[model samples]
Target: MSVVTEPKLISGNANKPLAQSIARRMSMHRGMSVGLVDARVERFNDQEIFVEVYENVRGEDMFIIQPTSNPANDNLMELLIITDALKRSSADRITAVIPYFGYARQDRRTKARTPISAKLVANLLTEAGVDRILTLDLHAAQIQGFFDIPVDNLYASPVFALDILHHFRGQLDDVMVVSPDVGGVARARELAKRIGAPLSIVDKRREKAGEVAGMTVIGDVSGKKCIIVDDICDTAGTLCKAAEVLMEAGATEVHAYISHGVLSGPAVERITNSVMKSLVITDSIEPTEAVKTARNIRIVPTAPMFAQAILNTWSGTSVSSLFETDTLVPIYEGMYSRD
Candidate 1:
């Protein structure tokens, strides 16, 4: 018989609340005390990051929860330095749990001289000594190929689907899931199937970054309540434009379910003025005050999903089963009910 070792959970400066929530869930599931690693992640006067693991992690399985969110460079560096610290401390394994992967939208080169920043970020994590990666809803699926180590890309579709059910309360026949652009049709289709709704796509032309020149509805959304779905909503330009086109095409109501809410610059303002009734985003990235103050935006916590994923990873079990949308409602309701 082999031995079973307890895993150690650590958190970087990014998204501390989410890390804490996951730690609690893990502890609850174990029915024993599971604690987070006590560590200090700070910066120097010259802005160099420093990380210290206060406890001995020698031979222990280590998982660091750090979303490469805003202040992307700093959070990214923190993740790297924390991984290096755990590696130097002789941890048996290191898995970086990135709830929101930054620079993911730059996965491909639209122009000849453009750099593929997503691959560069992946290379940095591997070189920083990460044995595996756990992330949610990568902007591009092909980004998994950039990593040499095992990468588990979790989906937020189940979470969104559950919320949709609760929001609409079994009135899904008139609802339709829409892809904001051609690239996101697959994700939208999966979500539509999960929610038992129709599927539609918006054909769009991007004149430049953070700008959508035009959008055309590809399917019949007439008299249907459209739910635009996508992975990220950075500047909210495309989302707003899509909503307009969908409404023009006679959608009864327009809402959106996007995974990451980067909400940079005029995003909140744009969303506030858009035709969308509500913009539901996951709490993968820590929300800013502007997000909290946005009237039309609502946040769904992803902590339970991520917590279960961490537990499964530590036990060497497949987490893909948890990805099924049908399993989400009960899991989410149970977890939140206890709170």
Candidate 2:
């Protein structure tokens, strides 16, 4: 329970479960109350978004919980409308609590003359009168620099580490941590140090989106159980391809721990046919029907991490430690840097 000084909670149509959990954690003290306004959000004739808040919000600190995950445009519009409604009603401050920020991968222009949509999204949020931003495990860490407001980026590795320790119990040496691509080396190395396991990397020559060439393994993965970790899993192509590479490198078993599972466009079918024994993803964003019913996909509830983060944020505490890496095994010096 956090000692909340003063604040009120308001939620949108997106991600109600996470909102409720945050509300419960932040409201653990006295002299503070929070409630969500019944929002009537609808699309008009030309698919334009319309919204109305059905309650009073005068002088209240408002937090709108929405994950711009699936149907990215609609969810982003919903968040904008929610902020505008609260602002017009004389709310003291408005905070956009997005667990999964979509359009994060477009942080830069890789192709010639392409747009940086992440910066555009940041501009829209600022124009919508959002005073602060709270999100988790962005695909690109640099996305935080795009926001003009105070941005708190939380991490879920601590939550995942505890679950992994529970899964492996006393035997930690048989495990090996792997990053799906070279870009995710930091995340993979951190997890490897946590479990006292060795690290491996995937060398993927990506020809195009949803297409990667399985070249070779970069570390010692032979005869070890492989655990691939990543920040986002969009089409599942990178994940499945990396899994197959680990198998070819003599990994006895393969599993994955991904944060936001944006399983889009035939991802489930491909993951079902992949060699990985299981793929575990967090519920930062709501799971679609395909992901919820997938045979190989398993969801690890992030309720506790969300709860703790909400508590810390409301109480004006440091959340930077939560952003650090995690492990159950003692950290070996050269294996990974503890700094």
Candidate 3:
């Protein structure tokens, strides 16, 4: 029989608070004191990255929590360097827990001569010695095919579903889930199914990135409370525009629940000025001060879900079961009830 090692957790500079939260949840799950691995990830004078592991990881299972969010290149480099360091140190296996996968939007080429950067990132991670991948809702599900290693692509819908239930208690009859664009209908449909709500899609034409030329609502959102669901909200343009169309279609109110809040550029400002009633996002990427102070923006913690995922991965259990709404409702309800 082989020895089973307790998973060792480590993190890069991308989102330390989220890493710490996951560690705390893991400790609770194990019913013992579990601490993060003592490691140093820093930058050199010339902006080069450096990683040094203080503890011995020989034959140990290691998990690195890093989201390649803002300053994507630097964080991605840090994850690669940390994986390389752990590999050289003889860790038995390394799993990268990327809450927000940067460059994922570039999974395919819309035109000739453009590089598929997501595939390139996958190659880099594989070459750097990642044994597996644990990530939340990727921008495109097909991006999972870019990797050779086993990848557990988790969903934020369960968590969002629980939140919607809590906020819309006794109001489900008024709720309707909206997909901001045609491509996101599937994601929106999943949430709609979970909440037992009708689904609507916003058919839009995008001339280019960050610009929505025009849009039309594809369903009867009239007199209904609309909840837009999406994977990433970078500039918030699509979401804000979708909200406008929904309200014009007679939606009583509009809200959004997004997986990765990549609120870059004027995203926060746009959200503030938009007609949407609220914007709910997971803490996949660290929130900026502007995001924190936004009146209608709320962050739902994802640490508990990710912590459970890590525990399941370490024990060689079925991670896909966590995706079921029946399995997640009680888990998340217990977690948020304390708050």
Candidate 4:
């Protein structure tokens, strides 16, 4: 553990409640509120963002909380401006605490001439003056290498996995861990191992943009309770389809454990109509009213884990043991009554 002195707390206009929650959990007071010049965001006709940090942040260790969720461009820009503001203010360290990192799904160019937006987002953040980055549950693991600075790709698996294990107790056997797509097999496997469950894969193909329906099952799901896992459920298109496929493939129950519920567009309606028994998502991103009130959708919090991470980081402690070994081993150890 490296000694980090004089860490500061600076937050953007995104996910204020979650920021406050994290700060509260850390048992720290907000150094100073970054106020706006104008209460109403009255912008010029050009639609350019206007930003001003009212408080001074000179020589501070600054941590900015912003979830680049809906209105991604705006929220992302706000984060950048906050970072730039902190950097210009001579903050000793500027850590961007983004709970939900947007544009992470496009890590590679799937088609000819397509942009690798994930890399672009990383470059943009780096260019925007983020000294180090702390985020949760990136869609792709390799995105950590995209940043030159020390990047912390936190996992929501522990939070969700532990919660599911406690909720379902001994009814875990015959439960299948499912990856909605092939890309998420590693993450799904981790969660599956944690819960002491077998694994399954959903072979899916996207028909068109903003549409995801399942095609076939790659593993046996007969007479099993299926928990479909994915990093982000943007429109619930893929998850809805996966649940339907699992249920159709003789799965007794089809549940989805997603980390971030961006749930844009018709996501709420889609999940409402899907055959899934329940949809578990984290509060990494804020939930809309429809999502909040939805009966099937449940939110697990990442605050405790993230709060612990922040405290551990500030305290020069090693959090490397956090889900370091295959999450499944310890999970199954707890299962089967094994030490």
Candidate 5:
């Protein structure tokens, strides 16, 4: 008989609530004691990150849950330090669970003499001794190739689909899934298929970052409710502009569903004054006070999906089943029993 090892969960200062939620779900559903590893992560007098694991992790499977969200540099440094600590402690396997990978948007250099920062971050983690990586909805799917170790990219489509159904409740006939840009058509199309809706693309031209030159709706959205889908919503510039264009093109109602809500800068203010009815996002990144107070923003919990993925990874089971379900209730029931 093969022996199954329970993986220990750990968290840094970045998004601790999400880490706790994942750990709690795993313990409740798997009928086992899945506890967070005790650790101290703080900055020194000069703001240098320090990490120390209190519990013995020697020869133990460990998963560190930390998202490179706000204060990106600080959080990223903390993750690297945490991974190094785990390695020195002799952990059998270390998986860096980054729900929202920062610098992922810089996957490739678009201009002359620019750097591919995404690859640099991947190299940093690998060098820090992370045995594997588990992230959600990378900005560019090709970013997975940047890492040398095993990378499992989870999706937020399942969570978003469930919320859409419950919110609309059998009245999705006139609903349409829209891609905010040509590059995101694949992601939008997949979500549209899951919800049994048609797909539309926003043909947009960007002159530079956080600036939209022009946008046009490619498909017929006349008198239909539209849901713009994308992997990340950084500045809300493109999304807000796209929503305005959709409304002008005769969309009855406009909404957005994105995997990561990196709502930086004036995103909250922009969304509040835009035509989008609501901007639904997954809890991959911790929301700011502005996001929480925004009347047009709703957050969908992704803990259930992440919890099952962790279990599957520890047990060497396929984690792809998580994307096949519209709702997460069955996954929360421990669908792949280890008995």
Candidate 6:
């Protein structure tokens, strides 16, 4: 496939603000009026999604910015319909920019009759004519293999690390990064390495989904400022419980940095009432009213990183460099620099 100079951005109803932010970042980088494509994504009386592209996109590089977050099925269907519309409109290349990919937790079958929904979602997107996939912090890294097309899984660790550094202001003493579970040790370790902090793990057993049976701290956290790092925080039972456990273990204070804040059910309440000082989440998934109003919850923007990623993908440049600790500072500074 040949490269297209002008890229067209299209947004679904999933997260319009984030899409707009990405477009603004792109425009700032390119020094041109790079805005979203003129398209109408709406629903009928019976809630059937309908998409119509008003502007001509023939032979144009197209990017659809839509995260399949809450109301997962509706948003997922909207993405498919949008992709189909773009394909039929003769767009040269179609890339789906999904910040938060739904059905990711169901990457594998846990029971006899269960299905691998993550793979199924990938197949659906492929069948819908998505040429490339760009997502952030997938629950499982192996989910990339589910797609036959090119998959670019971006890490939020660099962004998280910058925020953590800014929050702590170079204070590395008595700080600890804790993984909520054994599966998340890698993610936590990456953040710890970036911030030059010690790493710990919370060994937890799950009786079922969203319920923690028991937990054990794998490292010393006594009298230290504990920071829990994880990919997703749904229901937040494990997260809140882990924070309580850390306090009981004599930690001075606790905080959390999660990539995707699913925050379903009693998650917000749990975080609000828990011993954690603050819960910082990325804006991959749009924050709901509860999340926005939560006292101790904070959000870090991902638009700059994603905007840089999209530009890299469009220009055939290296996307991995954005996550490198040394390179990330200059790149991030450049994003906000007026020069």
Per-model TM against the reference: 0.95, 0.88, 0.97, 0.87, 0.95, 0.96
Candidate 4 regions exceeding 4 Å error are: 1-6, 28-47, 212-214, 324-339
lDDT of 4 by residue, 1-339 (tens): 333444445566667677766766555323434322121222457877666666666666678878898888888988887777667867667778899998888898889999999889999999988888889988888899988988888887776677677777778876889988787899999888877789889987777886664478999999998998888887787778778778888999998888899898899999998898899998888888999999899987666566666656666676554554343334233432222
lDDT score of residue 103 within candidate 3: 98
User: Model 5 scores what on Cα lDDT?
Assistant: 0.89
The 0-to-1 C-alpha lDDT of every candidate, in the order given, reads 0.89, 0.78, 0.92, 0.76, 0.89, 0.91
Cα error, residue 291 of model 2, in Å, equals: 1.8
Give me the displacement of residue 332 in model 6, in angstroms: 3.0
Ranking by TM-score: 3, 6, 1, 5, 2, 4
What is candidate 1's TM-score against the reference? 0.95
What candidate 6 gets wrong by more than 4 Å, as runs, is 1-3, 334-339
Best by lDDT: 3
Residues 229-335, candidate 2, lDDT per residue (tens digit)?
Answer: 99998888888888988998899999999999988887899999999999989888888788889898988766545555555666678767565444211211122
lDDT of 1 by residue, 1-339 (tens): 323488789999889988988888778888888878999999899999999889988888899999999899999999999999999988889999999999998999889999999999999999989999999999889999999999999999988877887788656888999998888889999898887888999998977876677788888999999999998888887788889889999999999999999899899999999999999998888889989988999999988888889888999898897888666556576532311
Displacement of residue 49 (Cα, Å) in model 5 is 0.7
Error of 4 at 91 (Å): 0.6
lDDT by residue (tens digit), candidate 3, 199-273: 989999978876778998898999999999999998888889889889999999999999999998889999999
Cα lDDT tens digits for candidate 5, 146-250: 998999999888777767776766669989999988888889988888878999999988788767789989999998999999998888988999999999999
Report how far residue 70 has shifted in candidate 3, in Å: 0.9
Better candidate number, 2 or 3, judged by lDDT: 3
